[model samples]
Target: MTTTPAAPVATDDVRLSAREAAERHLRALVGRDDARLREDQWAAIEALAVDHRRALVVQRTGWGKSAVYFVATKLLREAGAGPTVIVSPLLALMRNQIAAAERAGIRAVTINSTNIDQWQPIHDQIHAGEVDVLLVSPERLNNPGFRDEVLPRLAATCGLLVVDEAHCISDWGHDFRPDYRRLRTLLAELPSGIPVLATTATANARVTDDVAEQLGVHADGTSDAAVLVQRGTLDRESLRLGVVQMKTPEQRLAWLADHLAEQPGSGIVYCLTVAATQEVAGYLRDRGLEVAAYSGQTEADERHALEQALVDGRVKALIATSALGMGFDASLGFVINLGAPASPVAYYQQVGRAGRGTDEATVVLLPQIEDRDIWAYFASLGFPREEQVRETLAALAESDRALSTATLETRVELGRNRLESMLKVLDVDGAVQRVQGGWVATGRPWSYDAERYARVAEAREREQQAMLGYLRTTECRMRYLREQLDDPEATDCGRCDNCGGLTISASVSEAAVAEAGQRLSRPGVVLEPRRMWPTALSNLGLDLKGKISAGAEPGRTVARLTDLGHGQALRALFREDTPDGPVPPGLAQAVMDVMKDWSPEWTSRPDVIVVVESATRPTLVRDLADGLSRVMQVPVVGTWAIRDASVPPRAGQSNSAQRVAAVRRRGGLDADVPAGATVLLVDDQVATGWTLTVAATAIRAAGASAVLPLALAAQG
Candidate 1:
């Protein structure tokens, strides 16, 4: 069958053709007659074709950011100035590059503490200006003896310097490294105007900016264009995002066994803990589901072998962590997020691993309600505090022996990246020793535990505020999320708690569709004046007395977050049990009375409307929506929409507020809606009711003869 090629997508950004990129690399590696290249490798090659003196390659993990630099190194190498130097983060990646080079008949070498002996010749060749390229880690560069010897020797003849996994430059990076900052100076010491190329497949816009800024590059030359450099959206159109709501880990395991037996594909099941990873992998393997486990604790060779097994069909399913996805390709059909993914970034990166090289794929996000509070507490910690770094440094200096990050977590209360950052900074100062296997302190002492602990805790509080802001912002969740990551399609999950809690899910009947409208309910969870259950109950008794309803919303209950709740309450409310948890004493009555007696601005249809403003990271919104839905389960209409009021609109209408009002004339609004579907207005609550009145009217004129409004609250 003859097929027509798709029209080039008309994006403002320039895209590189794989053929052009490969041809350029082939010419550069002219002497290597056996260089085999894939389309992805060529695309990366073209992306690395730099006009600017310094370049950064941020492609998808498997999109070959290394090849881009490797090919560029090949070009720069044959130019015959001096040997090129590569600073990589991992020993495994360096080994991968060396192996590929050897296979291609080109010379390459790596220098990490584990393989320091093999690097002796590489150091001599670099000093003598005879080697083609040398790869080393940043920790090695900061070595006092190596600083006086290997780096200075190579800097004299080095033509190009490449730093791989450049996202580590970001303070927000999953793996931040302070050692990276010092490498910026090595180029200035080099003679040939050694242009640096930093590369990664994972940096978001913020990380990208940090990387360029840290490298001291103006970054104006870096295209503002987003290449489809990250893995393609793997929410496969052909694969359904199946969901299994479970209470305990065991139930999930049982569910997986049965489900895979019914519809199996080379698959992956992810767990947040190493113990869980082993448990799941072992359990599945024992149960006769070909399985393997991958975690940070797994040996590099073992992890790589598991990845290969997934691809080669040696294992039909692998239970692993984020370690499996960064740069492996598996033509698998399924992935299951066995727990609430930590963040949208982490989730995207992990789920992206599935469906690669396949025509289609599927992902299942299995949720545990118990995970919510932990996630909330987690989101509360957004960024690492400077004080935390300072404190960590002091502790490391004081300690005589080296310690692993995991060990410090127990000895100290450090957030994930906070611990990684301090260790990275210590490595830069040469005050810490990165042993053959782990990290340890080198100096006599700096500061003890108490003072540093307070500083880090205080800093964490500040970061928690920022993370709370992201979760609670009163703007279009899509635009808000984009502002955070500068990427597209983040707000797509239809099942997030946020999406489920939307006005549509709670709005009143179709008969009252024209009367109600949607809005954001404020001061949620911890950040605002939270309407706690006990407090509301006590207050209602003290204040409203007879106004509250005793028995209502049949077979429904809610667990509300007060300004504060002890672990005992949290566990009782969230831990899987009997369906939905109970709201703090009187809060349930408050929500019920509010939904039943509270009037939405408009009227005609359903009793409530649920509107999930954002879907990117749906945990918060979904929780509110689902909670409200369960309470007002009596057939409410749900509306899925995004409200980005911040981006100034076209012509006179500057934002969503005025534009949505103007929409009253057209089919109500522009994106897309069923022509005759009724419009039931929804919002978290109505303070003055202006937003509801406006939204309801607009949707009414759009089609619905009536509009109904509903919310979590209503004012006097």
Candidate 2:
């Protein structure tokens, strides 16, 4: 019903040609995709593509960082670029990204640990310009063959390099990986001037600087030019951050269960150690709750299963270490920390894991007082002394040539594992050159001086102390993050342990038993050992002065006796008057009781009766009297390794040992026992009864009158 309309005449007055008109029309045909049309997101996309070719997006966790890359990748595909290459550290992320891209009808594939062995096909596709995107890992890029094979081909196509969790390039980040260093080398192999877009939830000034320098964008190291898109405040009105200091591990777990019972929302329970992770998960599982555990040692298949279970809600709570949080996207309503996180960066990362897909989430940290001391020990992380360094360096210098770390360490008396860390430190300092099996000393002294080492150790100690200080940080945790990001207008985000319901009590001076403290340095009258025995007497039963004559002249005096089974400390221990001089008063009774109890009705032979104080916790014998008093009724004694327990955990052992001998009669357990005697041994728990069984054996061996185990809890 229509007639062809005459073609409109072009104003070709020495101007608009038909081709120019067609170009104009094609240019206008490029319409904005609705997928990225959100006002803020579109602004970000346009700013990225047209305004800033290289950008750093500091978005919160699960703010759709992948979406940003998706829009970019699609635009590039539309422009007929050869292909896009994405360098992703997490294999799960690569898979998810590939799926998302495919769902969006964009051709994309992954090349990483899972498929590096069969990378030939993927490489071929890249060479053929068949791939729309290739996801990679830093480790894969580290391979010379892989880089040479794929980078050049894709570099010619000139798409883009998207880096996920790029903060790892900085040492300040929690999960820094050395393989990330090789990324620049891969970039060099790729087409010149390709864009690099890196994203992370937590990168501070130091991290941003490191990323820029490592990527070569910070040539001349312009720290200010580092691209960062600051995301505004997120909605977390429902989150409640709470922290609790517990006295024991079991108590912490029990408290956690009770808290979970109150809410019972989707959550993740993070454990500091792998053993704890499994045990906690097991406890939950035993309580008829679903649980999946993740640790560094977990198998790849198991990790994948657990992660999927987390996403699917098949598992109510996933007990994991920090390793499980990478690239995991779960709008988990709650995240719980079983102990103090090793670093503030870790704390932020773990807490950020919650409230991903939802507006409301909660984070809880159960800080046990016992763990405070443990973490404080790590906070004072020790590096070997310069003497240790010198010893190690001397060993390295003397090494025949080209030795591995393991081999080099064996040559030193400082110990192999402990000695090697210093060597690596020297290597890092550029004082030594490592080639193959051994290190060739640079002959350039690492300024080998004690002061320099001291400074370096101090710097490390300060950094750790800073992390420890976070435990007592009064501000909300999110505000802490803002401070780390170097923002000027920061506020206490009001969803942290301090801002929530945690109320701190003012320190009150104690009036009762203030003088009962175990401080040995308080000004006091000269405190001397009891005159009942010599001050120099050992903890074990022994006569430091003269051999205790078993049949000494009878008198009510602190007399020593030989073969009474009393330890050297018995020489100093108080003695009760006996018919035969003064015998270690209660010691003889304990030995006799152990002998009789071990071998029902057996009279005990004289055995060492040392009064060791109650050693409820494992500690040094000298620093604090631990495990000093024991019932001599047991045949065998418990010995402590002479190694100094007082030394910091990181420092090597002091090489000390303490022995506990059995309190038993020379006669077997079947021997007759004297009437009207009493003995008791205390334990926290009697699990499996093996400890009691062995105690009976020791009592019989020590010639104890009897052995009776009185534990708080005994299993039938």
Candidate 3:
């Protein structure tokens, strides 16, 4: 896909003066009668309205990036151009932009996943010229129906095309989306005189160049036009940054509980994972703080409510994951990170949400030792393997009919989300197409581009390393982050802790730490049983599909290995380099406590204790089972032994299908427990729970009435 620019139309050659119109639009947008357009904002509007040339604006967050587009849209519409089409990335962003447009008296509408019911009506409005701006998600550009039908119409008549959060168009950007790559097609198809504008607040120099190139700006005269690049300093003078190194997650939680109320106003607390967000928010709420957990698992309506609550200062903060990172709008008074993000670029973007309109905002980072482990977990889910891609292509080529994602799952081993992500990347590469009901092979030549993917992966590792350096750096902390983004004019801000010596206190009260320890140490997380079998198990020679014939009983784990409190200890105990031994005395004691405190929902008391025999860590499994048996005063039953010692281990199983196949073939029931007896089943660590499920199924079939699984730690 090529994104060459159209020829530049000089300002003098333009027929209209957009400066006065832009100022009028800005006043309405900010609700100030005397509001004036900033010079950069007016320049961008003039380029789009008068000069009809593509422009990329890279500025700091809260620097009126939205104004450039809104004013440009108003001026273009008044000139009788087609409605402006904006390719926005996030739902929150769309909501904020639409509201901003309404303030400026521009008729704006959005087409996203939430409002499919109104898509046709919105389409009608666009065609009837009743809308001034139409905002669409980047993912919509690849929808077969939308691309084939609506996109052509949009391209033919669009007044101007705006790519919001344009950094996502470049792989070098901290947050890259495969869907944004399809903007090349949209850009190439646009009419000759229709202008384009790409806006972002977090891009560094490298990302700027990549985005500019994608828009057809090249060093040699290869493009149809030249791209006008406008970049500004990224320094956020209102943000006072600091890092507090906490030896333990408990200390971090204790600090927050003791000090969150001291913060100036409502803000955000970012956690690296969904589980962490829930745990942190729960702990804060227990301390009588007004806060809520927000993550990808949060329902749409609940997310909206939480966003509103934070905006209205009803809650102290929203403990959130990166799901709440971008497009969230609030002049938040502070931003705190439970642990560092994988990269400084991402870190800046998350914290940038704070102090947008305030005189000062506190930005603190509480670095944890387990951050690397969390980073590794997410890194494992990157681009699919070339073999997997080939398999997907071959599978699609085998049939003439289109296949939905669910149906395709039968033939591919990838999880549903991963499969969809791969398909999208392939679609942009022209190897596949999303049809009405599903997907079809385009039969176009496609290469895996191994070198490029490998390079990107290597870049991610470098970013992770840079984040560690940022935590330890003594030079200005804000400058460290800015330098990572390739900000050329980066300088010491003299505001961060490194520049201004420990602004946030490192000490936490003993009472708070004790309370935090008690809360975190109260173990046992409910382990829900796997309800449905992985789809298309039959394709893998297993006669399993839909719901399982007999699902395993809900089980309990002492704690998630990723839990902030027990996580560090549990992780060290389970490290690959750690020598295997019988269960540690302390962990064993914790296990007993977990059993003693098991909730009433775990109604079935075990009469017999059975263990899933382990080949890799036999001593650990046996010792744990023996300890549990002694505590429960139950007879130790036989084991669910491995059928073949040579069977591959399930240690690194990444997806469900491979995990199911591995566990089913390697282990089986050997216990002879009495009928109608509840069995206490024990295992070392449960990652996907397939081993536990397989063992439980066998035990039940072998005469046990029920199985209650117990594990040392659960790996989420």
Work out how many backbone clashes candidate 1 has: 69
For each candidate, give its TM-score against the true structure: 0.52, 0.59, 0.95
Stretches > 4 Å off in candidate 1: 1-52, 125-131, 179-182, 185-192, 217-244, 261-267, 329-333, 370-423, 426-484, 488-716
Per-residue lDDT over 467-582 for candidate 1, one digit per residue giving the tens place of the 0 to 100 score: 34434454443333333445555454443233332221111233222111110011111112111111122211222112212111111112132111122243454344624422
lDDT of each: 0.51, 0.51, 0.85
Task: Point out where model 2 deviates above 4 Å.
Answer: 1-48, 147-158, 184-191, 216-238, 372-477, 494-716
lDDT of 1 at 638: 50
lDDT of 2 at 429: 56
lDDT tens per residue, model 2, 1-716: 22222223335441223223222322322332322233444444444443334566666676667776666666655656556677777766776777777766667877766665667887777778677778888766534465555565565665777778888765456566555655554544444335567778776666666676555433232232334454544424455666666544445555555455444357788876665676567666655677778887888778888878878777778888877776777668788888766566667777888877666676778764434444544444345666656766776677667555544433333434345445545654556655544566776767656775476456445545555676677777666656655555567766566776433221222321131111111111111111122222242343332332111111111111210112122322312231222223354443334334434422433232211112332222111111224333332233212233343322212111011112111112322222322223333323233223333433444444444443222211
Q: What is the C-alpha lDDT profile of model 3 across 585-631, one tens digit per residue? A: 77777887888777466667889988888777899999998877777
Best by TM-score: 3
Q: List clash counts for every candidate, in order.
A: 69, 79, 5
The numbered model that scores best in lDDT is 3
